[model samples]
Target: MVKNPLKIFMLINCLGMYDWSLSAKYFLNIYVFASTIQNSGSQRHMHFIKKTLNMEIFGCFALTEVSHGSNTKAIRTTAQYDPTTQEFIINSPDFEASKFWIGNMGKNATHAVVYAQLYTQGGQCHGLHSFVVQIRDPKTLLPMPGVMVGDIGRKLGQNGLDNGFTMFHNVRIPRENLLNRTGDVTPEGVYSTSFKDVRQRFGASLGTLSTGRVSIIGMSVVNLKLALSIAIRFSATRRQFGPNDDEEIPVLEYQMQQWRLIPYLAATYVLDHFSKTLFMDLVELQLGLLQNDKSIRQAELGREIHVLASAGKPLASWTAQQGAQECREACGGHGYLAMNRLGDIRNDNDPNCTYEGDNNVLLQQTSNYLLNCITDRHQDKVRIESPLESVNFLEDFKDILGQKFMISRVEDCMDSSVSLAAYKWLVCYLLRESFQKLNQERKSGSDDFEARNNCQLYKNLWATVLQGSKVLERPSWWREFSSYKPTVGSLKSKL
Candidate 1:
């Protein structure tokens, strides 16, 4: 390890941005790039150039295009091999298909890890794969031949970072440019991969979803913390109606205000706890993958972890948005200012719901994955470990759902012991609802894409509903709240 003090300080000082989305992206890229290089030789020079020198080389993963953001399989950018030159020719064939909305692509990127459909000899089209293409010379910020890149201009938020649209017209990249960890092709045009199953291939393509989900959870937690800190401090100081004519009371003293804010306080606390625990689960999953465990348990864990993170991110982002708005109202006029940070936080988080994968589209992946598990149970197949084992409601499937709210506290809404009960109701309800809607669309003679689009409305509705239920039943919130209690009793004895 290099014992440079200056680099240590730079790394230490990076956590200053409390809830900013761009800040989180900056941090993630830093950590990921470091891990990528220090731990492996796959992209060492790229990492060194980007981070070690403070050079602003924003190399975004160019997966999503203008025409299709979440739908990766539908992207049209083509990469054709030139056997004579030993290079690949990349192009966006039409207007609707250019790479769009990629961070670091606009003005700062010297290179991009672009994803495109690979067409080889005999015209066999391989699914999406990444290529590290040189966009600009690292020293000179000019575009390379056959590469077109520029910003998408101002966005809803995170405008400090330039996100660009890209078009590739006959761009030639050396044969070695491909990241071939999952799949590879030879000079003779024989394409092969370790994963023969297309579903597994697609899953490998989206393995990064774990990190994306983790970042969203962390970002949402930070946003919630900032909002709650502001609101809590402001609530304690702000005066409102009181029983006596001569006196004023703090906003927090009111039951309604307590109902609105304190529950969220409890919620924010819980989500923080949950995020940390889930991160540990992810760490284990990573270790399992690295160890080449490849047991049925490992695959099951990967799917479950993806489901948890996907389901959890939308929940946190939506909560943060609501919490920020409530915090703004609680702050009266001050929260409206951009400097107060609530509004900006809200705007930045808005894209989280739609990006990475549309929260709705992603939930279906989780539900589909989970429903497959349920089908396995129905078929009397032996099963591997599942996070749902923590929730007994899934086993019974009949007893607790629709079992009356019993009370109206936020705590009641998210009772940990019976939390899975709510989750069952939420999932079964949405699953059935989506099925019914999809069936209706098909019965009415709509095509597959049209039916899927129409079904998306229910998808959004059900995802939110399911997430809300999970929050109440899971122990994440209560555990988080418990940690904040005064531990003076135990500390005194130790002292």
Candidate 2:
């Protein structure tokens, strides 16, 4: 965890280039699960943590349900405390309540940190709680009695790791299995926690969720890097028609190719930088968890991380998704070949846009966070700030809005500052506009849900680079460009 961020991202880039499935497998098996137990599990869970870190035992995280994906509070699985038996009975009330898309559980994992609603004596459900459940035999990998587990067979891509689903039918575990860092149930069925506020308890319990999404941002950048590396190299070397029969030039000489591939190249570097920086901020959040900060600032840090990750994941994943497609198309027939790995890159990147959280849903999450910021700014006079200082700029929204975009010369566009100023203005403008829209929708009798969704279009402005040289020059062409295509009889006939 203390490793250099650059080295880690570089490793992710290299491993993902060879195959994204390996990169995913590495994270799902080693990183997130370890962090989850550390954050949510108690001292009694030390042996499990030690074995996991030593790679002596395998584990997976089972939180997402088949029926309820994002709406975690409404998840249907239950873990009821049996006072006389001194055990908790875990059950999936229906097929829909079964956990789905659990990584590592499909084949290798013997244990899982299963999330389910905790019930005490008299069926008093105390919301969602995590429990350490042994799902398979240590030596034989057989499903434990009362548990029905199976692999979710193939899909779009990243099939190297087996994803799975499982349902529990009165599966029983000792009362000590509950990961009760935030809240715990007594052996006598008494529930107690430091935070009496249910919202605070929920926030503290699920703080680790943001970490997984933060990690996904880096993975997405790696996919973009791999795609850009392959496509840009191909563009630079693959020759096209020349100015004359004796003269030929690479397709990279064309402006269109540069326009298509160079931006993504720049984006990879930018996202790479952001991913590293964001992960460093993640260290602060993890520190608070380990120290049990329990302060308002710690709670603010959690909210900040959630907002950033909710937005950043979509930004990086969608960028990678679009970049991969453009790269595949830019390479023409070569990109389509499976051997080249371009198609693999594209398919692998596609999952990022959906998993962890769907990009569209994430965009709405970001918007809701923004709306809250603006509302506080307007009504409570609370300063727009975050542990990461990401939203701090909004405090001067009035000034930013007042500032005008005034670059007249085309030469000014080459200066990075020019675009940056315009981008800031654009962001401020959108924030202001969306806030008003939400108010307008509410005035027109729309609920918060409807107002938030309606404002998604304007709330999506977030992160982009490049400049001069012999840059935009078309040195030679007829080989790959349109200039020579008309002359070729084979192509001319088609035209």
Candidate 3:
């Protein structure tokens, strides 16, 4: 409902700092549930979006099953078409097939966008499809017949959110409930889509999926901002032993303290810029979807955004995780107290590393993206590029890999360009080595799965870090940075 993409994400992110559940409410309503309906559903679903923004209806996204998390294609929840009634029978065949980790379903959501393996009356499984299924009564807040739903109980943090689980026992929804923009079933029991290839349809679907991962990049950045505010502001005021015996100084004045915390501050700025840019890229993708642009470039745009969001979430989450820990430890005993909110920040950030997508597994998506580009360049004899031109620099990988770090003085390293050059070389070097390692496994009779699984141990591409390096520079107010006091409530960038 919020028109500006940047402000929408920023507002959700800042609201998260106040209380994660509050932000999760908007995030689920707008980003995850409604956004999917907007993209993959037709005009009939537009009113759901409006009602959700108006608080008339609440919703949850049901995709991850109890037994399967990220392996979405293998999920067992099924929606079989019954042409006789013009309805889809949604079912959870077993306990493991139940929808798990569903936000808002615990106690509040009145409906869900349930994903199931769609089966036609002819018994052909047509892969995953989204359907709007009402799970709770709007007034009573009780589960509907054949709907099993409840909260997951107290968590380490973000307990404000009623995270829950669900199962459906032959629950039937109208044929029109299906989010049918990508794939739809006729009342006569046939599955059809505008897309000629299943792969193209799947590619179109990634745009809806990538929205969460992309937004989390900004969420993680904001976490770092909060932790940095508490730590840096504390460092600037809380005095300790100084150069002289009688004169105590702020802990921040010490070289060691600065060394430990300053890189994270620098990282915060780098990541902030990276998060915003990645967000804008996703905005461009959604804009294309709005216009219904199905060009090769549009398909490629989804893929490129997917690749960046996949990796950006991990980098931002991990960086915030580390930053939170460092900031907490830097505060010493003061940080351990709950009122200080360090522990809350640390615990809230832990889920970011796992949710949306696991930090480690998502990086492989980036690795695979880079590999596909490399493969296209070599085997297909095509240029390595994207509509975003993110990995287009790989066209000069050979030249970049040929270069060496030649900086010999401390002064030379002060400029961030030195770091960026070294990082470019490192990415190119790691990429070529990873490519060789994967090929070696393949040549050794390893199948696609084995090749990928075996090569997971290898270091991989870092496009997010590439962006981070570009933004990591000394503050223009470095001399006056000692006067840089962070605001208590607002986490605004002075630069």
RMSD of each: 8.0, 7.1, 6.6
Which runs of model 2 end up more than 4 angstroms from their true locations?
Answer: 1-13, 453-495
lDDT of 3 by residue, 1-495 (tens): 436767778889879889878999778977788888888888888888897888788988988888998887798999999999999999999999999989888999999999898999668998888999999998899999999999978987788888899999999999999998888988999889989998777667545778888878888888899999999899999999877999899999887679668988888898889878878888887877877888889888888888888878877888888889889999889988899888899898888988877876787788888887787788978888788787877899888987866654445555989766776676777778788988999999999899988888564334444334223333344433444443422222322
Residue pair clashes in candidate 1:
270-477, 414-472, 419-473
> In TM-score terms, which candidate is top?
3
Who is ahead in lDDT, 1 or 3? 3
lDDT of 2: 0.79
Error of 2 at 155 (Å): 0.9
- List TM-scores for all candidates, in order: 0.80, 0.89, 0.91
Q: Compute the lDDT for candidate 1.
A: 0.67
Each prediction's whole-model lDDT (CA): 0.67, 0.79, 0.82
What's the candidate order when arranged by decreasing lDDT?
Answer: 3, 2, 1
The prediction achieving the highest lDDT against the true structure is: 3
In candidate 3, stretches whose alpha carbon ends up further than 4 angstroms from where it belongs are 459-495
lDDT, candidate 2, 51-104, per-residue tens: 876777788889999998888899999999999988999999999999999988
